[model samples]
Target: MKKLLTLSAIAASFVAPAMAAEEVNVYSYRQPFLVEPMFNEFTKETGIKVNVKFAKKGLAEKLQQEGEYSPADVVLTTDISRLAELTDKDVVQAVDSEVINANVPAQYRDKENEWFALTLRTRNVYSSRDRVGKLGNDFDYIDLANAEYKGKICTRSGKHPYNVSLVSSMIAHHGEAETKEWLEGVKANLARKPQGNDRAQVKAISEGLCDLSLGNSYYLGKMVNDKEQKAWADAVYINFPNQNTTGTHVNVSGMAMAKYSPNKDNALKLMEFLTGDKAQQMYAEVNYEYPVKEGVKRSELVASWGDFKADKISLDEIAEYHGAAIKLLDEVKFDL
Candidate 1:
């Protein structure tokens, strides 16, 4: 993926000079299918050609390496940790557009405006329908440590960004010492060594490997739509943990402006467009992600899952404890 992104970026450079003057270059961690529709619509509306280089990882380092000569006008990424990485690495600059400010809530964006969230997803607990059934509203994330569920829980790697952010939120609410013990307790209850993606954990539940698992909310929507995965999706009921306490841990897919963007006007326009009604609506319909924009309606399938009260804690605060969360995961030997 790294080599491919590099070669694609280089290929983009040769083609860039011949492209229309009204163009913006995008370095996206988002998959092309998810973002292309919005980009196409943006071009249709503004006459600005959108050039994208998509990769799963290494975009931040690539931007830093390119320095002032980087053709990347904007960067798109999923997870607050990735958004924090861009700001921490100094590869992105603050976007002060009034349109973006109005579109995204303060809790979902950087305090200094370096990054802005476009969509929201929760870190949910999935309970096996035949065994555990839907968990009660009183259930909390900390409850994953309870002995009653021992030998019945499954999850992905603790170091994965989704779980790390959840652990970070735990640290935020419980302090590191308590959160470490919580991690230790949760590890003790694992159905097997932590492995696989969120959907894989759901599959494990379907196969009766575990009675409960941790996963992102959108994966349920995706699984429901997939022919082979629907049975996995059917085997469990998604429950938003910590409903009565801190609220469920929510993460975001977001965007930032490259520090040395050559086409500032077009880049800002794209950013603003992403926050507008059209793009927000597209995100909900195409990706099944909750739109960060307040007034936009969720997709019918997403809305069917019912509304959740997302953790009110600022994502910036959660990003602060990300390293601590990873350290806790290691300290607990969570995947061992």
Candidate 2:
């Protein structure tokens, strides 16, 4: 009886820790510097430890490979295509939260609640401060292709996800044929080959390599804050493209609950917290991203950039044209 009691106590010791341990696993494409503070705050508030596996790519494949045994409770990623890919691959599940629904606008979330955008960023045109003051109101995305601007613009590879999404938006606004033509024209305008990241293009403008470049709105803020890149940032005016027409193209960073989440309750709590004012505020201030939640104050620097109407096309609709966008880039030999 004594031996049996001892054995039972040993069993209980292992079981108790297993039951008492409260944690939620996360598979994230967002870098640690971007999300650690938010996760720490969440742990402080709820006592649920957040374990994250950060990766630049292949997170979707990892989740799929793990199947039902996957420990991932949530997924954090940027851009619509990745979110759409997760949905298409059936790795994430619908999260029907009143908090999330109230915090995010309908257009920023999946129609079926599979994913929700945490923040937004615009695809902006950065123009040389020395060469081009403020672009005219008529300066739309289509103007990038005008013969006058030929050999004056620079951009990253058209095959990149960011450019693909922009091309996708063009396809959404115009048809495939017109988007193809636009791609061809933009290719002709490249100051050199499409060869660098967004900031690289801005740096090129600073070096007088090009007068205009395609970049994200947040990159300007990032550059301005960095001592080295401040000059690059100051060298250009960030213009919201197509403001008078289709509005500037916007992209998002978002989160979703994994289909086989091991900690559903905690995962739900984390999701709600992220959409709340605190996390949303963090996103705005720390990353220079526009929060998805209404009334959340933007960073002073971001607000200083002034306001422009964002293209109201549904991201889902934009996502539908992704393949077509890629094909258009290839057909035009955009990177070549």
Candidate 3:
């Protein structure tokens, strides 16, 4: 009886740590369909289970409130602006993984290693291929303000985060004065009041209410694959604007290690795994995004759209300038 008791105690001790170490908690702004399969695959490959909580907003605040008691080991979110907010709030920590360093480009990863982008989404112009023809060739976003496109261009409200970042990129590239003028000019060219997401703008283009619009490249991918969206995507010719000058404005869906992650090692491992070829490819192929991992092929659909130079501006700068971009939008009466 004594020997059995001692053996039982030893077994419990070993099992407890094993059970604790086998799980990682994640707070994600990305939809479950976008992230779950990868998590399921990770568990299958490594035996480390993932516990995820999905929300569209307030994740950073939730993480901040949880603080040291937070069970989250990792955070995954879209857009550089939100990631920058997390970094500013110190909700995430810098990770030094050699795999991450090698795979993610410097422009896509935080300089201090707080976060790294796994996939890229380029914001570019889309136009009616048949309507513009040669005029669409070698076109750039800066050309949106040209008199010819006035009352012919359609886009989301500048209040939208995506457009804000694009405007911010212009500010970063052209300085405040020039950027303000550019915003006012683009505002002058609106086909109608800015009031929808990227897809809606594409719909407007397809309906002949407009001839061109700005949208993320992945939207085109989603459109082509989705039965309902195929017509709108098919109706437009994709153009990667600003290619010769500053490259296409790109953003990311990225990941970071939580500041008080209890499963630090596992979290880092997961981050590295995401940056690996398999996960990167899965992310891009599934979502119609460009992989940040070097040499990972984009989805055939994305590749079919052809390639363009991506803006080299550090996305962190885009984040930093977000507020000013919003102010510029207001000042130029972009919303009205």
Candidate 4:
């Protein structure tokens, strides 16, 4: 009878594993396709399910409204500025995990450990293969504003978060006065008043509307996999800017632990797992993002773009200048 009771207790533990079996709630800016698979993998590994709330915008405000009673255990999104935004709002708590510290680099994580970068993507210049050709690879980001490239460039709205973050990095690297001049110059060089998404700019290049475009590297992967956009993807070659000076400008997709996590331990486990080998590999393969953790190979499609050294500037340093970046974009009337 003692033996039977012990077996029954063991089965009960399996069925009811305390908080470990409880679901972790995540409020994510990342789209479902990019994050759902990772959650599925995590559940399979630990039996701790992940439930996500997807939003294109306003999740930050929602978390703030919920306050300490927030069901959110995590915030998942791209860009260091968004990560910094969470820290500024006081909605995220510090994560003192040694596993995360070991897996994430000092440059890609918050100084206070409130957030950690999972992946990286470069802000590259894509030039038309038939028009700009091999010689375009020799240009720098600073060259985009030069008169030699006048009326030959296309770009998304400067107010867009992606461009705003890039401008922030420019401020970090070059300082206010020089960056201000550069922004005005880029605005002057626009062929169409900064009127589309990054992929739209690439499409413009392919359609002969522009010879060059400012865009992210992963879009090339997305476009290559897309039937209608494959022609646009095939029409260009990637250029890593600032290679002669600070290296290429890059940004991250990162996550933070919510301040009021109801499942702190399980959340920490999921966070650590994301920085580990398996999840890092999925980030590289599934998302076409460069893994923050060392030794993970990029997807074959990404690898074919050729390797380039990433800019070594601390992302937090760039994020510090985000407000100034937006202000300068307005000063130049960039989108207009």
Candidate 1: pairs in clash: none
What TM-score against the true fold does each predicted structure earn? 0.94, 0.97, 0.94, 0.93
Q: Taking the tens digit of each residue's C-alpha lDDT, what string does model 1 give over 1-336?
A: 999999999999989876746899999999999999999999999999999999999999999999999999999998999999999999999888899999999999999999999999999999999998889889999999999989999999999999999999999999999999999999999999999999999999999999999999989999999999999999999999888888999999999999999999999999999999999999999998999999999999999988778899999999999999998888889988
Poorest 10 consecutive residues by lDDT, candidate 1? 13-22
Candidate 4 off by > 4 Å: 1-21, 135-138
Residue 98 Cα positional deviation in candidate 4, in Å, after optimal superposition: 0.9
Off by over 4 Å in 1: 1-20
Best by lDDT: 1
Q: What lDDT, from 0 to 1, does candidate 3 have?
A: 0.88
Considering every candidate listed, which one attains the maximal TM-score? 2
lDDT on C-alpha atoms for all candidate structures = 0.95, 0.93, 0.88, 0.90
Model 1 lDDT on a 0 to 1 scale: 0.95
Clashes of 4: 0
- Model 2 residue 127 CA deviation in Å: 0.5
Kindly list the per-residue Cα lDDT of model 4 for residues 132-178, writing each as its tens digit: 88543356778889987788999998988889888998898889899
Better of 1 and 2 by TM-score: 2
Q: Model 3: what TM-score?
A: 0.94
Instruction: State how far residue 164 of model 2 sits from its true place (Å).
Output: 0.6
**Which model, 1 or 3, shows the larger lDDT?**
1
